[model samples]
Target: MNQTTNTVHQDVEYWLKNIVVGLGLCPFASLPLKENTIRITAFLGTDTEELLGFLEQELTTIEKSDTSQIETTLVAVPNCLHDFYEYNLYFDSIDRLIKINQWEGVFQVASFHPDYQFSGTEPSDRENLTNRSPYPMFHLLREDSLEAALKHFPNPEDIPERNIQCMEKLPEKQVNELFYYLFNKR
Candidate 1:
């Protein structure tokens, strides 16, 4: 891989390890990540159509592969959909693709962007960091795996609330430093 791709991978790993798992944003993330069942593919395309194409390819790849080998896929798009609003708007197309392909109940799409913001939260709110990643990504997850995880995890309904509480309790300096490191702005 090229230097840029290598750097993006490293940054993403840091975010997954330090921010997501470390902060307990997604309690279910750590095991799959540690087991190497989560595939992180970097797509360097800037066009929306091209990115969608890549997403479809990833979905198909995971769909066809054995779930034991590949539990999930994270398509990292550093070049496209940098703007959170645009990224949010693009979900319609992703949903349509899933519908057209009739992959509902089989797989689900989750989103993560650098500037992700919750509906009622302010731009600077710490809760937004829960959904933020080093780069914009479309997470393709298996419904069966999700169900299995949820079944094993106690009170899965409280995860979001717990994550918000964790974010709210974090120091401002630490949050800012995490994002700065994620984007490599230092």
Candidate 2:
């Protein structure tokens, strides 16, 4: 990988470890992460077409692989979709792409960004931190894996509430440290 790609990949890995798994935000994340089954790729393309194509390739890659070898993928796009609203608007195309490819039910996309925000909350709300990441990345998850994980997990519906509470309890210093990329963009 080039230096930029390497840096972004490392940053994403750090965020996944310290913020996501360490905070207990996603109970299912730790296993794949520890097993080295999570794929993190930095997509440096700035064009929408290129990104969509790249995503299609990634989707195909994960879809064709066994769950034990490739559990999930995080495609980090640091060169495009900087605005939260614009990034969100692009999801329509993403959904359409998934449907067209007939992978809608097979896999799902989860979004994480530096400026991630929930619909009913303010941008400054601590709850938004739960979905925040160092860069704008699309998490391609397997529906079957998610279903299995949820079945084994207690009160899967409560995960969101628990994550929000976890975010709310964090100190400002800790937030700034864990989410330093929020303040310093590439």
- The candidate maximizing TM-score is 2
| Candidate 1 Cα errors over 4 Å, as ranges | 1-3, 182-186
Instruction: Please give, for residues 20-46, the per-residue lDDT of candidate 2 as tens digits.
Output: 899999999999999999999989978
Query: Between which residue pairs do clashes occur in model 1?
Result: none
Candidate 2 regions exceeding 4 Å error are 1-3
Per-residue error for 167 in candidate 2, Å, reads 0.8
lDDT tens per residue, model 1, 73-120: 888887778788899899999999999999989889999987889999
- Per candidate, the number of residue pairs that clash is 0, 0
TM-score of each: 0.92, 0.96
Local distance difference test scores for all models: 0.84, 0.91
Positional deviation of residue 22's Cα in model 1 after best superposition, in angstroms: 1.6
Question: Roughly what TM-score does model 2 have, to 2 decimal places?
Answer: 0.96
lDDT of residue 17 for candidate 2? 93
